[model samples]
Target: MTDTTARTIPIEAFGPGAQSVDVPVLDSHLHHVEAGEGDPIVFLHGSPTSSYLYRHLFGLLAGRGRLIAPDLIGFGDSGRPEIAYDLADHERYLDAWFEALDLRDVTLVLQDYGAAFGVSWASRHADRVKAVLLAEPVIRDIESSALPEAFVGAQRVIRTPGDGEKFVVEDNLFLTAVLPGAFLTPLAEADLAVYQAPFPTPESRTHLIRFPRNLPIDGDPASSVEYLARNEAWLASSTDVPKTLLTYEPGFLVTPTIVEWIRENVANLEVHAGGAGVHFVQEEQPQGIADAVVALLARAEAR
Candidate 1:
């Protein structure tokens, strides 16, 4: 059901020591890129991108620990099933990925939609998680009033019935616009193409389209709301597990209002300014992100 042949993404796209491992997850195979070895540092990328997103950090942190980055089901080169690409759908396959790889004592690096699934897993399996590194993460349901006007307008267009599909699928806004626009420094055509490669066809962009649509707007997508509530409880309760929140300027999900909210709500959370980026902190501040993870790993070991 899976290929162990390990297709290699060009180092040109991701940097040196990049290779793919196809593992049987759930009903199909999942493609993940990995490098180095030690305590596993699993990088979970958010919407509209794949394992390739962490190409820079994978080698940078090789001296510290194993770096494993997976393309969520229906994203990147991972298996694409004809299921509704909702939060539950992503989490179900991701749980299988964890089991398949037998990952434990995980240092989860989360961003964007990846936060939704990764945080939910870490909260439930707090015993398995060693630490968490978050950047521009979507930790809870969106508070529209706290959001930037531009972002709100964009969301409105994307969530609109006919417009959503045209923009996300047909026009391929996620890769064409959203991904490119997130970075503080613009991505080169070659580097940007790597992220764009996965969803070349509109039909292949099922997850990209659904990710925004499934966001917990006005308490809609009842399941995601319930999931975030549980995640919030776990975040507040799990003080034993270390949590690092890396912040950046002009961030979308981790905005100023959300930062204040996180301070009051999440327990045992240490927030550090990660320079500047809009949403894709990994794209803009890989070094800062890597340093934070290294520090968290050191702290975890010391404790």
Candidate 2:
């Protein structure tokens, strides 16, 4: 039987009756929020955000399946182990978490670096994934010049040695600047505080410092570039799997150029507009995102 018991996290932003869980994975544990019961519909969040990113989606997607949103290791309520916290580290932890839960026939809702993690995993385990829904995901290698000037500048600074530490660790730029800027409107102080709670000290912000540097910009990070290429090959060839891309007006990552590339290349893909937003489409279009996921699920069921 499915465990419908509610586990509490002291954050009002998660709203009332949020169900939390801490599952053992590797040397650490992954914290997640779950609702309903059936085949797993897993929600994976990206850098600087946690399971709280999908708090609204649980209710919106209620009764669709077992809704689960987990905070990637080193983020949210999850244990911060002594490790490099690189893409490989995150992937390893996530692989263990999925095995621990014994999730099967999963429908994935992914965004940001979560895209990299989920898509790569799905590529390796195609039979296990039922469907995929993505919004502003990191799916390919990007030229540093293709990014916005301000973003490129920020990445350069964050990739620097001492400067990177000061920018993310001391200043907490990811939570204070990058995250808030992703939303179309300003995030409320209360909601922002929920994201801030996990990383209270400079040491706690190690993952934040590492994430930007790990991006596959200009193919400098060969590992990430190779990883993305592998997933891209799977996306192009997996014609049987249903895929949905939720796009927002003037998106941050999935810009028009990239979207066009995706539509042309990825097989069995459907594109839906998620209204006006930047990187964080869920905050601006929770209902739209929910609708898209439902539509994808129906398509997968039909197949």
Candidate 3:
């Protein structure tokens, strides 16, 4: 059902490595990237993707602030824990990882599933979060299709009886099939290499296959649904968290109506639109996103 031919993302093509280290998790080394100086900005990525998502951001902001992007337990160079991976898994990982580094006064930047981890983590430590920037995070329901239309049937397909692995396929419809011309900007060949590096083998994609099992839309996608329920309640009551909606060229999957709905709603939300791409903004416009994050931080400071 999968290919074992380890696909290589030519290492030379990637941007410079800012800083690299590993978190101790048994025999596995959780690869992490640290760059920049001053206040720390810990980035959390979602399923099937790793710190590779922030290669450009890392390069752009490495001199401005300390950037720490890690490969979650089941993805990238991290140890595949052989356990089910989901939001709760990410929450625990973020809790422990940040604690290990003693990260404080963070400007947590998140996107996609990263939103779930970063937001949930920030809500737990409101005093630590200075500001936030999100690219179609997993804040609301998946069907909302506000961030990326890649949401709708992807989860539905994978959660089926035997189609679990389909969602994590190397040539994922989300990226190759659906994302082709839709994502904000086409990913640079170098950047695309990073996102494509983790799943070198079909069998190594166990996490990818299982990632779909964690979607909370269904009855109980993963164990974190309960935590997500709690996080939603927190998002509703908490007014201290400064959040922004950075919109790019999204596809029909995420109709303008859905994104507009968020633009109209959500308190303390600043929505900016001026680019194009189906979903992955970090890929197409890395510098733009980096600037936007810095700008949002300034806005939060002014208020």
Q: Count the backbone clashes (under 3 Å) in each candidate.
A: 0, 0, 13
Could you tell me the TM-score of candidate 1?
A: 0.93
Identify the superior model by TM-score, candidate 2 or candidate 3: 2
Candidate 3 runs further than 4 Å off = 1-17, 25-29, 144-155, 166-191, 216-226, 251-265
On residues 4-56, what C-alpha lDDT tens digit does candidate 3 reach at each position?
22323222222464655666644344667666678887777775577777767
Q: Which ten residues in a row have the lowest lDDT in candidate 3?
A: 1-10
Q: Which tens-of-lDDT digit does each residue in 39-103 have in candidate 2?
A: 99999988788888887787788788888888899888887899998898999999998888888
Measured by TM-score, the strongest candidate is: 2
- Candidates in order have lDDT scores of 0.80, 0.84, 0.63
Q: Which candidate is the best by lDDT?
A: 2
Candidate 3 backbone clash number: 13
**True-structure lDDT of candidate 2:** 0.84
